[model samples]
Target: MVELNEVFETNTMIRDENLDVRTITMGIGLLDCCDSDVDILCDNIYKKITAVAKDLVKIGDEIGIDYGIPIINKRISVTPISLVGASSCRTRNDFVKIAETLERAACNVGVNFLGGYSALVQKGMSAADRLLIESIPYALANTEHICSSVSLASTKTGIDMDAVKLMGRVIKETAEATKDRDSIGCAKLVVFCNPADDNPFMAGAFHGVTETDTVINVGVSGPGVVKNAISKVKGQNFEVLCETVKKTAFKVTRVGQLVAKEASRRLNVPFGIVDLSLAPTPAIGDSIADIIQEMGVEYVGAPGTTAALAILNDQVKKGGVMASSYVGGLSGAFIPVSEDRSMAYAAEIGALSIDKLEAMTCVCSVGLDMIPIPGDTPAETISGIIADEMAIGMVNQKTTAVRLIPVIGKKAGETVEFGGLLGNSTIMPVNKYGCKDFIDRGGRIPAPIHSFKN
Candidate 1:
């Protein structure tokens, strides 16, 4: 099955095209760690996560060395903390204490991040869910590696406007709490509609109840590889262009498949899916927007951007499905504003707006990610933004999420640097129109009629 030419092609992609495995995430269930006492519960969670993921970083580094393919991050996801800590947590401080324990465990294991400090309240919130949501700002401010997410909408169940409103205030508080650090705490928090349980990405990843005790999932990144392939067929027709992208995606995903299998075998954990998401970084030439421009769009937010993105997302799934039998977890293109250099430039120049980003999310993987807005922006306005995005995912039955940062004391056109993978962003302007009355009448938005398939 090994061919010399194919091997050479892969080597070229790695050396020049920014092709790499984005993450090797270990999903560890934490339901068994629950107890009736907060201290005991946190201790059990710490022990379980450390015991299961003790060797994750070592194995990830060893695999990268042996295979000569870069593995960017090693992370962990546990069961949603709300479910596991509900009976034990008496107050918001109890949740904060648990967050501290998670931070320690992540540091001890040497992982880049730890997720599942989350609550799933798509339709309604329990008493425990409210405590967790209220404590998010403080929890995130106190911990460095702990990430938080709250699910407020789904297709089967309607959007929880109450939770959406609460999240708006929570996000504002999170920004204020971390203002000294350029509001970095909000960067680690995500709001989701139809969130995926098996996602290998940060801020939105959790081990669903359906999963086993342990599993290994991989996320692949290759915007540069796809863009390079598109350049070769510059003057070709649509058929040729689509074929080129599909073939390039096949090669990129094969690398992820190989890494996933090897990591699972070495760790003695069951292999999960390969998430073929085109996750970009702050590095130039490795942007999803560049891939769109290669498809003939003048710029990222131009007229034909959405159409080009639709093609890229569809063909990537087509190619990825053929490369690996298990392709899941938001397996498409991601267009986070701060993480992608070109997208951030577009926003800085006023070429992109929040409305255009929302339109693009209808076809892309995640939505409205890493966007910075003015500090004085109203909480109702943020809730309106989340409501609109949730409507899109609910109607289309696709996953959409929001990670907005209301940078305290920052205005539009001003830059805030978050450093590292989060990069920097210029705060974008939002509509001044008020939607307080609309958000004040809080109730669930009814599910779509198409959800009656049963």
Candidate 2:
């Protein structure tokens, strides 16, 4: 059943094409750690996370060494803290204490990041959820590894304009709280519509209350591999281009399958799913934009860009589904501006604007990711942006998210260096007109007519 040439081809993909497992995330539930006392709650969370994930980093490294796969990150996702700490977190500081405990657990477990500092308020926010949300700025400003998300909209529940307005202010406060580091704290926060639970990615990963207690989800990425495959057929017809992307995605996903099965067997955790997201990096050629360019777009925001991206997204999903036993977690192409070198360059040169990126998100995977606007951008404007993206996801019944940073002290055309996987972002100007009246009239935006199919 084994083939030598296939092995060699995978080796070449890893060595030359930038193929790698982006993350191996372990999702753990904290429901049993809930307590009525804040101190006891913090203690219970720390012990549970540390006990369950003590070997996460070690086993991940061992597996990478044994399989010759470059595992970029080993992380953890827990049940949303708002739910877990509801009885104990009476104030914002109480929630912040839980965040510090999570940061400590992350350090002790040696994880690259720890997610699920979150609250889900798609329909409405509870008292505890509000407290956790209020504490986000302080929590993120103080912690290094903690990542947070808020689910403010879903197709079934529509967009929560109340949460949207609050999140705009929360994002602004987060930027101000961590202004010394180019407002890096906001980079660790994401606002989502219909977010997936088994996502092995940061800033949006959370162990859904409905999910199993412990499971391992692996995220695989290979934009460079996809690009290299289709580049062989440059100027070819659509049929040829699509076939190349599908076959290339199949090969890349099989690597993820192998790693997932092996890691699950060794760790005694359930294999969740393989997320074949084709997430791009700062490295040259390892970019979704490059793949789009090879597919006939002059740049990512060109006239034909959305069509190219749609084709790529559909084909990648088709191929990945064929290769993996189970596939989930935003399994398509991600177009984060800050994380991809070519996309970021496109924004810098005015080839890509936030408006074009929003259009692309209508077809691509997630939305408005890693975009930096000027600090002077109003909270109402940010709320308007969130409302727009959430409306897209609500109407189309697809998952979309925003990870925007109002980098303090930076203006349009200026750059903030985030470094590492986050890369760098050039601030872009927002619309000059104010949307204060629109945001101030905050109430829940009702679900679409299609959502009445009960």
Candidate 3:
């Protein structure tokens, strides 16, 4: 039970620390909506999503108002459309039609984003998976509010280099398809290694087959709260700093638990899990970099940046588990470049490079998120980058993903404005060296020997 003192503490977090529930995502399974006819299948999908999520926005708003907590986004995740549309979708256009239906449903239901226009090709690709991956550029370009992800690697199955090579081309095509809008389509696409089923965050959330028909998942944000808590312990030893962070994360996550239960009760959906991710926004105080700096780093991406991130990530999880009975999803510090103001600043000043960001991902939540490269980057180069990240996740047996935006008509030093929660970013340079020969060797990378644990 939450004590009265805890209620007051949560109020302080909200009032001063930019505390908010990042997203209240509803995961709707679409296996039941499958049909042999394309039009009929699209109709079934549209109807099911609309009906299931009609009240999601209303309930989320009411919850935020009643509890005086800010719920920033109401979103939805559906079963991967590649599987649902495979029997009926004869061509890439047919899958694009499904994407349009998803966008329409998301708009109708008043949700900001609808994820799961996705394909799973971790080990290899089915014909349907290949079609979905090929269609992603057109699908995402033609629609707004629809997000797509493709899984190309996993710890147990290893990396699918065929899919990796294909996705590198797909990402380039996606950027070209939406070049008029700052290549925003690529922003909605994610490539994953070891993707999770119940992740409340996007652009890589999908309802895994293991989930219930419908459920509510909450992603909580409290980087500012953490930063504030750590500041008070300045000059203290590492032990004191770690304990302070843990206690701060505990208080922040308790608020999330309260909101999740209330939302689940009101919406009449099973409470799935509370994602205790310290999601950072473009806002000044709400930055993972700032928290790292408060922990005494000179700047993010400095010499000791990775170590600071490791401490923050571990303590956040340790404390969050104490607060919530079910804590899943990518629960750690997020260091998305364009989304965090301090990280963006660091990148612009050359204090942070793509290499440093990649190194930091080894210790953080996700990999290479919202990073903008030059417009002329080669597809093979992008694939090489994805391969490196996939290898990390496969070896470490953790979730990692890539969301890269190659802004068209822009060079490394220029800035592209996506605005809103996506924020703006100065294009970071990539290594000019060619990796075409390496990427051309398209076959599976065998799973590590450690994966033999039965």
Runs of candidate 3 exceeding 4 Å displacement: 1-4
* TM-score of every prediction relative to native: 0.99, 0.99, 0.99
Query: What digit string (tens of lDDT, one per residue) describes model 3 on residues 407-450?
Result: 88999999988888898889999999999999999999999999
Question: In the order shown, what is each candidate's alpha-carbon RMSD?
Answer: 0.7, 0.8, 0.9
CA lDDT, every prediction? 0.93, 0.93, 0.93
- Give the range of the ten consecutive residues with the poorest summed lDDT in model 2: 425-434
Candidate 2 structure quality by residue, lDDT tens digits, 1-454:
6699999999999999999999999999999998899999999999999998988889999989998999999999999999999998889999999999999999999999999999999999999999999999999999999999999999999999999999999999999999999999999999999999889998899999888999999999999899999989998899999999999999999999999998899889999999999899998879999999888888889899999999999999999999999999999999989999999999998999999999999988889999989988888899999999999999999999999999988899999889999998788778888889999998999999998887
Local lDDT at 286 for model 2: 90
**On a 0 to 1 TM-score scale, where does candidate 1 land against the true structure?**
0.99
Q: Which ten residues in a row have the lowest lDDT in candidate 1?
A: 416-425
